[model samples]
Target: MMPPTSSAPHSAGSAGALLTDARLGKKPAPRLRRYYLEPGLRKELPKLHQILAVDLAHVVMLAERGIIPATQAARLVDALRDLRADPEARLRIEPERGSMVLQIEAHLTNAVGESDAGALSTGRSRIDQGATVRRLYERNGTLAVLDRLVALQDALLALAARHSRTLMPGYTHLQPSQPWVFGHYLLGFANKIHRAFVRMLEAYHHLNLSPLGTVGGSGSPWPLDRRRTAALLGFAGLVENARLGRDIQYLADIAAAACLIMNEINDLATDLQLWSSNEFALVELDAGYCGTSSIFPQKKNPIALEGIRTAAAQSMHWFSNVLALCRGMGSGDLAMRSPGHVDAVFETTADMTDLMTGIIETLIVHPSRMGARAQLGWTTASSLADLLVHQGTLSYRQAHHAVGAFVRHCVENDVAVTDATAGLFASVTGLDMALTDAEFRSALDPATFIAACTSQGGAAPEQVDALLRAAAADREADRSWLDTEQHRLASCNAELDRAAEILAAARPAGSHHHPDLAHE
Candidate 1:
């Protein structure tokens, strides 16, 4: 909303007036329409119906409090219901209007006559109403993302269960460093996505609060039933500080959470892109997700991975821009509070997550290729070094140096480490080794290397199984919370509908006036 030049923002002059021409004493510039008014109408067109949804609650609360005549409120409710049932059919844009809500106001006034339609804004400002509406819409967006994340968690856990002991090369500095269980790799990302679930829930807690009844950043003179309206709207509670209604810092919080999800997505997408390469050949995306080059018939590019990566890359600054727009500007600068890009951030991240979920569900993993890669680059050398320290009288450093020398000798002689025996290590290092050939060769075996990882959070099969169970438990909790919130919102909608219907029915067929309803 455009802040007023004089009075506090969200005031009659700033927000509620249909008299932009009369108050400003001039027509809005073409640039104002070109940039803000026209685009806001088009961009907000899909949600124009929501204006009635908010106003219904507001009108019902007004009639219940006897702030307006029952007859007038009934006329308004019936009109609101008609327009809301088909907003596109009932509402149209006029170039003179400054906002979509203004267009709605003009349309509603026309439908039910001026006095009754105008009663909807009695003790509220568009600032709080828009904030409430944005929160409600964003709650829907957040839950949508959570729904996708749950699907992703299911996919990850299922794949992890299938590959619990599937040994693959673990990488550091883009080089093979150790043998890692494929299940462990997937579990790590599942945990990361769950963290995003937690953060979004935290955002939802703040976003679910009601901002209604805060008229122009000050409490209304009317004995407004703020709590009642909040209940009707399904808000968790009221935003008690009227001034905070104008503080949209919660948008930055949501953006920050989305940024984290995108970061994890980028990491996974980049790794999968690298893994799907001909050289790595460890994993292959489904043909449905891959795009073939028109010029190169042999190419089956992982376009979905590229798409996920591109989506994440562009949204890294969503939260940053939100913070930038909100900070240093005082509360009176209401326009700074609502950043539009956060919606795009959530939308893109949800798409990326959903796309990745499909990729995971249909992914093709080459166990043979992963096994081969796991064995190359002397990935099991650390096992040999540890074994030497335990069996021989060498300190840890001495054992590491001895193993390094043996590795270099094997490379020079074109000997695979798997082919080396105790005699070969002793002959190369001239060290008296207590280990037998079987024990020495076993230390270099990838399967033995995996079995030996008995630490609390190791690559061992038991450890991965326990972690998977924990992930399952956490995912179940998240799914339950999402379900509860969805049901609550649905219940609130039903309640709001029932309340509007009752108030609309209070008017008689030929009743002259509702003097009793004013105080009823």
Candidate 2:
């Protein structure tokens, strides 16, 4: 219903009263249900209602029939089942003079039960139903995105394994500071993605709790079996209080999940953009994933990466929009009908999944180019500084300062550090040492330096292998989780199919007293 309006009382005795008394005044227009439900959501609106009505009708019928205890019919179960069957459902909101009313309209194409009572009767309010639908959509939506995230991780792991010994120049301040295996570098981002997946799982768990039975931000007089519906809809449990179910805290939790997805996508896009730049050029995106320039035929822009970056930024902004929406509303303003959070969440989540999957699937790794670049640019110079510290010739601070001076001298004089003599080293650092050409060569070899690092996450091939094995195991676990979730969803859908048939068969019967009764 539209926001409340103002009206003044008229004196009953005059001609004005007679003129005004002919009818109960014009009825307010039905606020199109889709205005709140359809703007950004992926699921169609009508289908959502069909699914919801059927499932809830079954619950109502069972309760009416005494086939099951009233406690077995949960609003959460009905909402969940409805979403699975038809992600888009529309309900009617009829506002009278003093109070608002809700009922599901009959005779729609998807309508199964002919009995108007099956669709129109509601022991609960639309506020709880809407909240429950949003929550179910969010929880499942995140799980779907998480599946893609883990798949991308698998792709990154494969890249790391393929390039475990492929060297690349690792930079600080846009200049080469050290050399590392490309696999080692890729694994760093993989770890970040892995953590993002974990965050998604945490959000999924929180969203899984059912909020369906709460009526108008308070408990209803009619008994609502919160837990049984939770089980039917695959929710772990209920959030308890009706008001708490639609509370700001619950909305914020949903928003937090959206932020997490956006952040991960932004981080990925940023890395891809930097790596694809001409200045870095350690890797070139495949032409299939790049866009052509309007003026420069030679320019191959990483538009997908850039688009992903922009989309992620936009999603975060929308998350803030929803948060602000929450701030503006009252503690129990259930009638506001701002399901923007649901729409925003589904759109952002779907975009994230598409971007993550696209990036991983089409990424082009150039091990040879990365290795050639790594070997150039004096990237091993840092090793020389670290070597001096290891040899106890200087403290790390002294060695750092000495190396900085040497780098400056070589850059100014247009000379290579390898060409500098042992006497030059003595002159620069005042170390009483006579180093040979072999020593200079050894210090400049990045492969030698990397191999010496034997730590858990080091660039050494052996260490990379160990980490890769662990990541592979984790990926397997992630796959199993996805499969289990899919199976559960499939079971929910199957139940809806059966329930739809039962309702369809019972529609023609004249004597059925309840929504859930099976047809003769």
Per-model C-alpha lDDT, please? Answer: 0.81, 0.61
Model 2 misplaced stretches (Cα beyond 4 Å): 1-25, 29-103, 106-120, 334-336, 339-342, 417-421, 495-520
Q: Write model 1 residue lDDT over 1-520, tens digit each, in one string.
A: 2221121222232223445756686666779867876667665665565567788999999999999988788887877787787666545556456665666675665565556657887998878778777777777788899899998999999999999989999899998899998889999999999999999889888888888888778879987999999999889998999878767888888899999999998899899899999989999999999999899999999999998888888888898898888765565665523566767876887888999999999999998889988888899999988887887588989999999999999999999877888999989898867678888878888989998898987888888888999999989999999898889889999999999999888877874321211011
* TM-score, structure 2 vs. true: 0.79
Residue 401 of model 1, lDDT score: 96
- What's the distance in Å from true for residue 53, model 1? 1.6
Model 2: per-residue Cα lDDT over 247-360, one tens digit each: 544556656666776777777678668978887776767777789989998899988788777777777665576667777777657424544455656566666667666666
How much is the lDDT of residue 301 in candidate 2? 92
Please give the range of 10 consecutive residues that has the lowest summed lDDT in model 1: 511-520
- Among the numbered candidates, top lDDT falls to 1
Query: Against the true structure, what is each candidate's TM-score?
Result: 0.93, 0.79
* Model 1 spans with C-alpha error above 4 angstroms: 1-17, 510-520
